[model samples]
Target: MLSQTTNAATQKISPDLPLTAKQAQLVQHILAFTARHLTTAGPAVFALYGDAGTGKSVVLAHLFNQIQVAARTQDASPFAHTENYFLVNHPEILKVYREIAGEHPHLLKKDFQRPTSLINQMAKDTVHPDVLVIDEAHLLLSQADHYNNFYGDNQLQSLLTTAKVIIVVFDETQVLRMKSFWTEARLEKLIAPYPHETYRLTHQFRMQASDKLVRWINDFTHQHLHPLPTDVGANYDLRVFDDAEQMRQAVVRRNQEVGLSRIVSTSGYPSTLDGGKHYITEGEFHLPWDQYNYTSTPWAELPQTINEVGSIYTCQGFDLNYVGIILGPPVSLDEHDHLAIHLDRYTDVEAFKKRADLTDPTELVHIKQQLILNSINVLMKRGVKGLYLYAHDARLRHYLQQRAL
Candidate 1:
C-alpha cells in the first residue's frame, strides 16, 4: 500500500524545513558518501547522529528525496546502485513521515520485521534496494517482534547484512524503553567490522538555540541544583507557567496563527481512550494525549489534536510551532534548592523499572533520576518556534518562572 509521509502545511516533511549550515553540510556529506558507495559497491554503513531537535529527520527527508529523484533519473545519474529505502520503527513517527512523503511511501515498518522477513522478502523480490536509509534506528529491537512472531535477535546486524549501504539516523538519549537494541556500545559492535563513517550535527536548527541556551539546558537537566539561568533569550520563547491552563491557552492561540502546535507532558502512561477521548491527567488540569489503540495514530498532525495532548512517545521525532509542557508530579525543586525527580510520582514506571531492580538501591535512584530528567529535557527542545513549560511542583514552577523573567 502506498502511504503519504505528511500533509502538514508547515510541519510537512520536506527539504524546505529549516536546516542549519552544519545540518546541510551533513546531508551533503551523506549524499556524497552514498554515491561513492554505489560506485565501488563497497560494504558500507554510516551513522548520521544528533540530539533531539537537531534536525536529524529533516536531513533524513532531504537525503531520502535526493536519492529518490536520482534513482528515477538514473540514466543520467552519478551512482551505480540507485535503489534505496527508508525504514522507521515507531508508528507515530511513521505516520508523520507518511504525511510528509505523500505518495512516496518508501517506509518499512520495523515491528512487522524479523530474522527471516527481510531475507525472505529479498529472496522473493530481487529489486529490493541495495541501500537502506533508516530513521529512528535506535528503536530497532534485539529480539523478535510480537506481531511478526518470527525471530530476529539483532535487527541492526540483519540490516547491515541485507543492504550494501545503510545510513542510520540515531539518537542515544531518545531510547524510550528497554526493548531498543541500539546503544553506543552496541552501535560500536554493529558497525565495527563494516566500512562505516560517522557524521555529527550539534546546532539546534529546530529551536534556533544559542550556545548559552543549550549550555543552560544541559546544566539544569544534569542537576536541578544547577541554578536555572535567567539569561535564556527571547527568540526561543521559553517560559515557565504557574498554571497548565494558561500555558495551554497560549498554545491554543499560537496554533491558530501557526500550523503545528500541541501540549505534551513528561507523563508516560498510555493515553486513556474512553468514549472516544484519550485522557492523561486528573483534577483541574485535565489533559489528554491523542486518542489511540497505540502508536499508529498521527496525533500531532490532526486538526482534532488541538484538544488532545501528547507525551514523549507521540511527539518525539515530530516538530511543532509551540510546545506546552506539563511537568506533572514527578519533577520539582526541593528545600535545598535543587531540581528533584520523584520516581513514585512519575507515570512512566516502565522506563527503567527492570534496570532499577537489577542495580543496588543507591545506583537505582541515580538511573531513574537521569532517565526521567533526560526524558524531560528531550521534550523541552521539540518546538521549532517556542517552548512553554507548566510544572506541577510549585517550588519548581516558581523557580522556573523566576528564571524566565
Candidate 2:
C-alpha cells in the first residue's frame, strides 16, 4: 500500500497513510483551494504543520502526484502551462522519493537542495513555478554565509516570492541543528500577510500502536519519567536491552526478513578517529555511523548499510518496519527516580565546551538539554512496526523496561 511512488491515481498510498479523518477533510479543502488558485490570480500559501509521524509527508506526496499529473495531462490542471517543483532538503529523503517515483522526471536534481543552496539558485532561476512544495522545512539553515555563502535576506521570504501557491511541510520540534530556522512562530510571522490555509495532521499513521505511545514518547522527550508506561499497546513491541550487540543482531535479523529496519541512536557514542573511520565500540558491539554521512546517505534503502548505524538526521522524515535505538549517555535515570540529561556525556555537546568561555553556563546547559531531548524524541518515533532500545545507562534500561510493559 505504501509504494515509494504512486503507480496510478487508483493506487492510493496506504489506506492507513498517516492522515487522520479530520486531516483528510482539510485536504479536500486544500484541493478546492488549489483549483481556485489555479484559475484565479493571487498569492496563496498553505502549511502542513504536524509533529513526527503525523502523515504530513503522505499528504504532500499525494498532492504532488495529483498536481503533476494534472499539469502534465492538461485535464484537471487549471493553467495551460503549469510550472511546479517538489523541494526536499535532505539527500537521503530525496533519494527515497526519487526511487519511489523512478524515472518520473517530475522532480529535478536541482529541486532537491539545501535551503541555502536553493535560495541562492532561486535568486538566479527566472522560471518561478505556479506551485511549489518544500518538504522538511525544519532543515532550512538560518546562517547563510557559513553553509553556502547564501547572501539572501531570508530563506523563507525568498521561497514565498518564488511561487504563487506554495506549500511547506514542517515540524517545529524536528529542528535538531542549531542552524535550521523554521519554527511555527516564524512561519506565522512570515505568512501573516498572505492568503493562507493551515492544516494539521493529528493522526499518526507511522505506529500502529496505541496513541499512548505518542504521548509517552513526548513525555520522555521532555524528561518527564513519571507514570512509567507499560505495554507498547496491542500491536507494538518496544523493548529495552542492556546488550548493544544483542540489539544490533535483532535489528539485522528483522531487516533481512522485512525491509527498512535499521539501528539509530543519539550522538552520545564516541567515534574512534582511526583515520576518520568512526567505529563505535562499547563492550561486544562495535558500530559505525552509515558509510555515507547521515545528510545524504539513504541508509535504510541501501543493502550495504545493514550493519551500519544511523543518527537522528538520517532517519527523520522517514518510516521503518522496525527501529533499534541506543539511548547512549545523554539520557539517564537520576537518583530522584526521574529521567536525567547529562550534557557532558553526550558527544554532541562537546562543541559547547569551546564556547564555555563566552556562553552563559545556564544557557549552554539548556541548549544541550534541548538538543539531546529533541534527537531522542525523533529517533524514538521512527518505527512503524516496533521499536527496540538499548540504554547505555543501567538505571535508564530498567526504567524503559517498566515503560514497555
Candidate 3:
C-alpha cells in the first residue's frame, strides 16, 4: 500500500505529541520564563532560534498548548485566565495550525492568526493579550507594507507593545524577501532593551540524511560546491540528474510509490501575481508554477498540485517524502567552481522589492544574492527521505552529475 504523505498526523501540530529530551527541556525553560515575567514590568521576549526542520515549530505548538491548558483549567497556575494567541505570517502554515486547533479542545481556531490580522484586531478591540507566540518570525514585515494592510513600522515591535510576553521562532537562513530581511544583529538590537532570553536548537529532526550529506548541502548553499561524499546516498536517496525531464519522471514515480514527492525550483523563470499560470520550462520538462491555493488544505497536500511546480512560498515550512529541485537560471557555477547568483535572471519581483531603509548599492547586491541562496536552501531541505537535483546551467549540471558518480 502506498503511504499517505500529507495526512493530518504528519502535517498537523498536536500538543499531546511527545517531544525529544532537548525539546522537552526547552518547554520547561519557556514555562519558567513565562511564570517569572508574568507580573514583571515591561514585555518579556523569548526567542527560539533554529534552522529549517530543527523542530522549533513543534516546541512552540506544545508550549502554547500547555499555556492555554493551564490558563483555562488551573486556577492556581501562573497563566490562569490569561489570553494568548499564536501568530504565523505564512498563509499555508497558518492553515495547518488552524486545522490542528480544531482537533484540540483547548486550542481554538481564533487562537491562531496571521501577524497582521492579530495586530489589527488587537488595536481595534483595545485589548492586550497576555502572551503571543510567533512562528516563522523571520517572515514578519520589518517595513510598512501597505499592500498587506500593515501600516506599522515593524510587526515585531508592534506586537511587543501590545503583548506582555512574546515567544518567536526565527531562522535567518530562511529570510527570502527584502522587506522582511533580518540578521542576528538586527534581531538582538531590537530586543536589547527588553527583558529577554534566547535559545538555539541545533539538532536535525527533519531529514534522515547523514551528517556529511547535511554538511555538503550547507556548503553548496554557501557558494561552495564540493564533491559529494562516498556515502552520500547510503542512508538517504540523493541524486543529480543531467536532464530535467528525467528528474521529473523520477519525482512522479516516487510520488506514486510513497506520495508527497514533488518538483520545486528556484526563481529564475517567468512568474507574476496576475492570477494566471506562468510555466517553468526546461528543455522537455515543463509545468506551470503552483497556482493560488484557495482551499483550506495546503498546496502540498492537494492531489492536483503534483502537476505544478512548487515555489518557496508554497513549500517552505513543510516537508516532503522526496523532492526534485530544478536549480533555475539564476543559479550557476562560476569559473572558480563556486556557485554564482545572477540577480538579473531572477524573476521573483516581490522578493527584490526596494527597501527605503536600505540604499547602499554594494550592500543591496549582497542582500539580494543572499536571499536567492536562501530560497535554494529552503527548497533543498524540504525532503524528509530523499532529494533530487537538476540545474539549468550546463556547467553546473555537468559538475553536479560528475560529483554524483
The candidate that wins on TM-score is: 3
Model 3 C-alpha lDDT per residue in residues 344-386, reported as the tens digit of each score: 9999999989878999999999999999999999999999889
Poorest 10 consecutive residues by lDDT, candidate 2: 5-14
Show where candidate 1 strays beyond 4 Å.
1-6, 9-12, 16-25, 39-42, 76-82, 103-127, 147-150, 268-278, 293-297, 349-368
- lDDT values of the candidates? 0.69, 0.70, 0.89
Query: Residue by residue across 142-179, what tens digits does model 2's lDDT show?
Result: 54444347665556677777677878888877877555
Alpha-carbon RMSD, candidate 2: 4.4
Best by lDDT: 3
Candidate numbers, best TM-score first, in rank order: 3, 2, 1
RMSD of each: 4.8, 4.4, 1.4
Model 2: pairs clashing at backbone N, Cα or C within 3 Å: 230-405, 231-405
Local distance difference test, candidate 3:
0.89
Q: All candidates' TM-scores? A: 0.82, 0.85, 0.97
Per-residue lDDT value at 286 in model 3: 87
Q: After the best TM-score superposition of candidate 1, give how far the Cα of residue 37 lies from its true spot, in angstroms.
A: 3.2
